[model samples]
Target: MDRNTVEKRVRELNDLLNDYGHAYYVLDRPIVPDSVYDQHMQELLSIEAEHPDLIFPDSPTQRVGGEILAGFSKVVHEFPMLSLSNVFNEEDIRDFDRRVQAGAGHSITYICELKIDGLAVSLKYENGRFIQGSTRGDGTIGEEITANLKTIRAIPLKLTEPITIEVRGEAYMPKKTFMKLNEARDENGEEPFANPRNAAAGSLRQLDPKIAASRNLSVFIYGIGGDGSAYGQDSHSDSLDYLASLGFETNKQSKRCKTIDEVIDFIESWQARRQDLDYEIDGIVIKVDGYEDQEQLGFTAKSPRWATAYKFPAEEVHTKLLDIELSVGRTGVVTPTAILEPVRVAGTTVARASLHNEDLIREKDIRIGDAVIIRKAGDIIPEVVSVLVEQRTGDEMPYHMPDNCPVCDSELIRIEGEVALRCVNPQCPAQMKEALIHFVSRNAMNIEGIGERVVDQLYTSGLVHDVADLYCLTKEQLLSLERMGEKSATNLLTAIEASKANSLEKLLFGLGIRHVGEKAAHILSEEFSTMDEIAKADAEKLTSIHEIGEKVADAVITFFNNEDVLEVLAKLKSYGVNMDYKGRTRQEIPTEGPFAGKTVVLTGKLTILTRNEAKEQIEALGGKVSGSVSKKTDLVIAGEEAGSKLVKAQELGITVWNETELVDALGEKE
Candidate 1:
């Protein structure tokens, strides 16, 4: 076919596919058969492959995802994405209604929407074409995740009409998809996500857009970014309708309540029937319908007064406490898990609940074989609420935590100021296995193919023990393991080799140090510049660096001083692992700047700069930006409507500077 004919065919295919996708994914009404969709999709893919130049940005084939991102860039939201205040009980909901009525000076219509338990995101469009999508990071700033968002078929690449706008929504995973994901993770020996919300959030945050696409995430656009009036909408319900009309997915379950009583009834009905839904909803969001009324109500420092969320009470069920099992974590803390008789709670079957520690078990007087009342905290983690003493018989046996490690049989020791007993034996098999899993995790050494199951296989097979032993893995040894194919084994080894080139911070974080987290690892790497320097530094010198507290210092000292850790380090060095910091060195940071060597705390909202930008600027000038104001804070950069942190700074007599002063100090003109 000629170029013009090919172009026409491409356009025709795009329109047809997009319409079919919208009808199926967004509307949940399939307009075409699976075979028909696949045939069209294959034709489009073949055409795009043949004529790459003809592929449009909003082509249906682009939803498959493109290249992997190195990292997400920070995006400053044009308008802040404020959270809504929560109302728990009936009284709280009534009080919220009273407050809204008093603020508006009249009766109000409330638009009640399901408070989807997922990651909140802002989607931006220019001339009706999707431009960017981001998280609701601290309201004012977020990470750019446009590629991931584009992969979500429910999110329209182009609107029905050409218009520039920004909309807020909740990106979520369906319960069925979440269950499948967890099952896959379980099979792969990877940690399962706590809930559908976490799965959605985790999927979106992945650097690879393909991962997000595979997760089958969907979005429910709730409102416009700034105001509905800008779009010629008079009320929130109208905005929802307009959004839906624009090819956006808006929840159809949302109701326009004329009175607060109706709103309460809606919430009550949902609280009872929530389990029947395909996705998770934590609460019901009640918003004043009129834009004029919302303008009058305005917003507080954190949340909008015009709207509030009514959180559902946690669902509880009574189950027999069959037994209690203990597991040792990477840090050697033994956690107790209550094995309960299978019972359904919060839409999932609950077979086990976290008992937290020995103290919790004793405090609640929980015993094996006793009838216990349990509930899912935050609709995720199952916990024992109370023992049903009335239902319990004298046959129930009291439970006690063992003094020795169940796996290694080492005598457990309880440290001062700590409640849980720890297995101090560094050679404990359970600890070693957990540490190996942590070492290969995404944030650590990032050996992608090595999961918990692989670690267990290697450990049990006696081919690996410590993190350093991973470097010694042979392809022959891997091939001997169950489910290990030649290609997967080769890929695993390649990943392991690639990990050897990672900077010092990755190794430090992967070492499973007691209190040294990712941030602390980065800080230590930056301060010391080399693992050797960090190892040589005493506790006093380590603690002198800002953000490296005594706890981290002690942990570092303890880690380096250990003979076993030293042997592991030696082996790792022999494997030619990179030990130097790859990020900006300490010398690159301005040593004689205005904020040099000062511990600064940022408070409130800055109109000019986002929080991350300000924090980065402060760090560049050798200033440590802390999250909270304390005695150690030498300066507080207070912006518009600074709250309790500002008050605390004033009480501590710390020097305070406004945003203008901060900019001026940094030698930048406003």
Candidate 2:
């Protein structure tokens, strides 16, 4: 128990764990069962907790468990991981070949590789040992992911040669791992990721390396990083061999093509043969053979001129549509899903397909009992292809979306110029649960470990009927839930507590209003920093804000004026959640000025600043935000709901700003 003794034990444990980690992760062999590994890890954690000085910076325990970070730490790539420009058609390919041929003179060979649909990463080695790994952020700098990258066995710890070098490659989840992830998400009641690329991005971006390690990520090294030191190579294909011999896992399917025809052959072969693999391959990468040729062709600021990616078409399968069922979204928007007879496509069984909106359904003439073709759009989600009416049965049912909310029975209302019909009920159970979840999501309250299944459990148990009820949960309440232990309960509570301190903008987006979205919420947040201010503001007052057109203004006023809605907000306020934030309180602040370290969204038309200018100004200020109003939204700049976002902001009382106001504010801030 003494520090002196603990340090020795810690050293021993770190060595043991690191070796075992290497065996299990890098070698794909383990000398101990996971139980034993867990026991050892627990002992190490206990020892480290007892004597903090005993934990090493590179300890294995540091990789898997830790507090989620606010953002990823940036690392400058010693050699940039450049993006390949895309060549969509055969003419583009010939054009690329023409350029390469002109650059290298007479004849030019190419290296063709399957475009692994995942994030690009770079690994650096010094004195034969892996030193750092980073993402391809902006091609110049990326987030440091050494701990996560170390978990992949394909990534070598030590190179065969003692040369200091960097390797570029794709980090992907196996189709099998992606399956498990989807299953796990479904089991947890969380929305499944759209594709394996998303799964890899989410997993690898985790602040906790342990979470990344659990995802079973793999890597395939493709290019050798160019250091100023490599004065020797005349072409790019030669570098591939140098990297291949240096203990890196390069692609086996890569080909050295002497002509564009060969490149086309490689592309067509992979297009047909991609199904035989256990992973997803979206396209093919064609690169000029020589580094000299690549340089002669030169680079655009964003992509290399010598290389191009040719994407494959999505995989489609013809099958019989058995029935049509409508699944209600969290917003009470009923989406029609085609429940088809089971058909295999894209390495998994497909039984259901998205019908998009009613308009799309009508346009496609899709119906129950119709023969249809299904495709994994981009090899990700299932969608219906053209219906084979040539084989339709007389028993086929013509589908119609319900006019009322299935769960809340609220009359569905579609906004002007919008295709979606939505329930306006704030108290709707389905909406409430989904809203609460959105509120606590990473973009909103960002409560860690609180996923969809856990949200479902709270709602099902009646412990959480609304957003305010989540704050009322105690350790005992959480621990009593399935799979929630004491430590988990404490952590969940801590995350929830932390979320309460988030800026008002996030809260506004998470409220699940019909029309308000992220951009509108940002606008609203800056206009009324406090929920009280927004709640008290009338439709006219709301509309007075820039971009708050009549449609959006009316929706906002309707949401706040509801009695039940007022009650919920009052309860949430009483529960100690901050209904106000500092960002929105100042009118003199920039409408478009970089809300440095703050997130903002723009919706509708801005009278003061153009949309692009507003976005640019925000980015310039070091503030980051995106489209789609969700819990993650920091502010919404609304010219109008332009749709659901306007209503959402009013319900949540997020700040609203007109385009002119935003443009003027942004200019003034700088």
Candidate 3:
């Protein structure tokens, strides 16, 4: 085809695909079949490949991921993304309503929306073209994740009108997607993510855009950034409607309440119905309907006075406990699980519940074949609430803690001052599987695509037996596994290879050493620059460090002294796994600049630097930036419309600097 013909066809195809995608994803109406959409997309991709110059940022074909980013850059929001104060019960909601009424000096209207349990992000558009997307980091500054955001089909790449605006939204992974993702992780021998919120956050923050693309994330634009007055929007509800008109996906479940009573009713209605929805909503956000009312109420230091969130109470259900099952963890703890009759709870089927320890089981008087109430602890883990002794059958049996490991048949022992029954066998198969899963988890090695199912397949197939064996895995071997294609195997190999460059803290945490969490791993990495130093250090040397308790020190000492651990360490070292910490070491800030070594708190609005910019600058010059003012605060940077924090700083006799003075101090530091 000629250049002109190709250009014309590409433009036509772009519009066609974009319209179809919008109709399908945003409006939830599929005007075209999957085959039709795929055919056009393939055509667009082919044409784009032929002529790279024809490719545009807003092109429909660009939704698929491209390059891997080194790191996310910081972005300053045009307006602060202030948090909403939480109201748990009816009384708190009434008090908030009363305060709002008093501030406005009139009866007020409110907009109630489902507070989606997901990551808050801001999408910026220039002349109706999507330009940037960032996280709500520190309210003012956020990490730019434009590439990752582009992968979310709900977020439009371009608007219908040529208007410049910034909109705020919650990017979420739907409940179904989260479940499928966990199922995939289970198949791959990886640890399952706790909730949809965490999975969404992790997907958006992935260094590789391809990872985010694979996650099937969605977004709901709530409101525009900065004052809605500029957009000729008079109310928050109107702004939401305006966003919807501009091809942005806004939650349709939102309601405009005439009074606080109506708002309470809305919240109550949603509490039961939220489970019916595909996405998760932790609470209901109530906002003053009118823009003027919002302005009148204004904001406090941390949150806007015009808005509040009413968190839903935990949902519980009753089920029958069938039997007790024991499973060994990475640390060899044989945890008892209550296998229950299948029952619907918290929007999912609950077949098993956590029985923390024998003491708790006895305390609760739980028995097999007894009817027991089950509730999700923190809306994630299922646990037994109470045993219905009255509903218990005569054939119900008393539960007993197992004295030996179920997998290895080794005797289990409870340590002094510990309630957990630990299997002392280091070479237990269950322990090995759990350890491998932990090694490739998000907080550990962060090796993407290696999940629980993959680990099981590898272990059972004799392809891998330890963490070091994972690093030596061939792409051919990965391709031999079920459902692993050439492309996926290549990506997995790349991810595995890249993890070798991670800082020592990741390796430390991935090792599955008892009591060594991410924070503890970081502390250990910072304390000892090399793994050799930590391995050789005595318990006395470990305990000398702050926050390193006797228990932790002994655990560390014991972990390093194990023969299997030493062998694994030697193998890891030989395979070029970095043993030296490459992250920043903890040190005292140098007292050299105007803000040096001082604890500084910022308040109100500023014309020069945003809150995060000021914080970063102060931190750059060795000053510590704190969110709240206290006795320890050496200085408070007060900007226009300074609030309660400014008053508190004055009462504490702390030094206060205006924007101009702060600017001068920054200049002097430079």
Candidate 4:
């Protein structure tokens, strides 16, 4: 559109937005669907970009942001976003009361609220309109993700009162939304999100407002940012009321306390009842209610002394370890898998789980006969907790790695300086089953509504075995399986038909050779450009490739050299499994830079690169990568829903950088 047309369009949008704001805010009614409002706002942005002169002061886009900021400019809090002092047990609460008595010499009141498991965000309102919103980046400074924040319907675009205030709260997704998102992603052949916290953080930082809008995000206002606006109230409880008066979506779960004992009661109640809540809450935040008491308790450079968060125990579940079985992969690595008594853990009913490797098995002392415990550590990944050694049987055997391929009966060998036992057998039946399973996995082949059960059924029924067998399955064959209706069989066949045209890397990943994970497969496919090139590559050349150490190189070389593997490849080729690789290595990567001398801890989900891909990039940039965040970390690439590492980064005041910032830092010559 022309500049004049753009200007005319923006004005019209602004008028419509103002009416919607009035209807939704002061009037307590919404005239448009949230999605429609979001789309209208996006339309204004596209127009304004081409005609900068069309941008107006009162535009809805102006509420979000202008140019992208290099980083957040620091702004001191009108009142500190104080850290809560903790009370681990009842005695600690009594101690807090004793301290309050010594200072106030009178009864003290407290306010308790759910500490939502999400990144803290601060939103500022000026003269009845939303002005600014940002992350709690380093407490004092945060990135201006205003455009994305504006897309969240829960965050009001305008306020009811003609008063300025800053609101502090958690930005999180509901449990229902999290599940829906995961399901949708799985259906679309994308990786499922780890958890709600991760889903929320990822949605909020989206560069495209449309992505943010599609997520259906929400937030809760916890506190008013300062003393001025809370009307005749000098207490924390009153501040929340003031925020509510401004039409913010404040949680009604907060309770006003008459004493520290009452505060403890509220905390304990939530602590017990948190499991029933729809959203994940990591803890409860308790604060001294009065502003006068807050000042008396006042500031440390790092945190305010007024409040503290009481963290919940990690999610734990216990079930019997029926047995430990050895599972041979397509690469013929005999890893131990724990067969449990079919207990539900972390939303999935896990009857079997990976023991990781031989080293981990030995370290955990996990015996087949023991009653084992499992924990979803930090509500994310599930791992074995500990074995109830007292329940062990005298007949329990000490586990050992196999000396020969359990499937192909080939001599097994442990690579130098590694713990896993490898079969290195290309024709191993077990590896073929495992690899074929992985390839047809929902994330890989995206077979609609198909899971391990369906895959196992297909394998058992002899309708499929290797990756290429999927191409040979007939509708008549699929319909013969139990519970497989004609409609479902047709859908499965259609999905399988579509999967034959998947990218070459996916087909490579489906092969599941030892040490060749999805990321590694992608790298190999992109580098070699064809299955023939990869099959022909020598060990030394394979090892020379990035992230392919000697062990992985040996495994890859050994697999390709086997005659059976060549025959399997020929079969796959006949059935049209993609053998043509088409990825270009970003060849201009620097071998030395500031990152070269650094040790970085990557502890969260990267919104773009897969974890292994990020690890490779970090190594290529000349940095050593560590799994956990620590004091020794020179830099940390903080990503969506960063966990303990983010806390550690804050504790040390380490240079915690985001992916975008990390890329920019790499762009620097130094």
For candidate 2, lDDT tens digit of each residue in 1-670?
A: 6667778888778767766765675456788899888888899988888777766655666655455556677898755677777776688888878877876666887888889988899888877778888899877778987777776666766666776667788999999999988999899999888778888988888877778878988888887775221413345566666776776766777899988999998898998889688778889999877654564566665577778899777678899888777656766677778898998886678888888788988999888788898898756689998998888658888888888887878888886787877777766787877777787876567788888899999998989998888889989888889999888888889988887787887888777665787667777888887888877788778888866777777767778888887888889888887788657354645344337566665555456666567776777666764543434456778784245555555666666666666666666664
Name the regions of candidate 3 deviating beyond 4 angstroms. Answer: 1-114, 117-120, 124-130, 134-168, 171-281, 284-311, 539-541, 587-595, 599-621, 625-670
The candidate, 3 or 4, that scores higher on lDDT is 3
Model 3 global lDDT (CA atoms, 0 to 1): 0.88
Clashes of each: 0, 56, 12, 8
Ranking by lDDT: 1, 3, 2, 4
Q: What is the TM-score of each candidate against the true structure?
A: 0.62, 0.54, 0.60, 0.46
Kindly report the root-mean-square deviation of model 4 from the true structure over all alpha carbons. 15.7
**lDDT, candidate 1, 495-520, per-residue tens:** 99999999999999999898888878
Which stretches of model 1 miss by more than 4 angstroms? 1-114, 118-128, 131-154, 159-168, 172-218, 222-280, 284-311, 591-670
Number of residue pairs clashing in candidate 4, backbone atoms closer than 3 angstroms, sequence gap of 3 or more or interchain: 8
* Best model per lDDT: 1
TM-score, cand. 1: 0.62
Clashing pairs in model 4? 83-307, 84-307, 84-308, 85-307, 85-308, 329-431, 330-431, 596-622
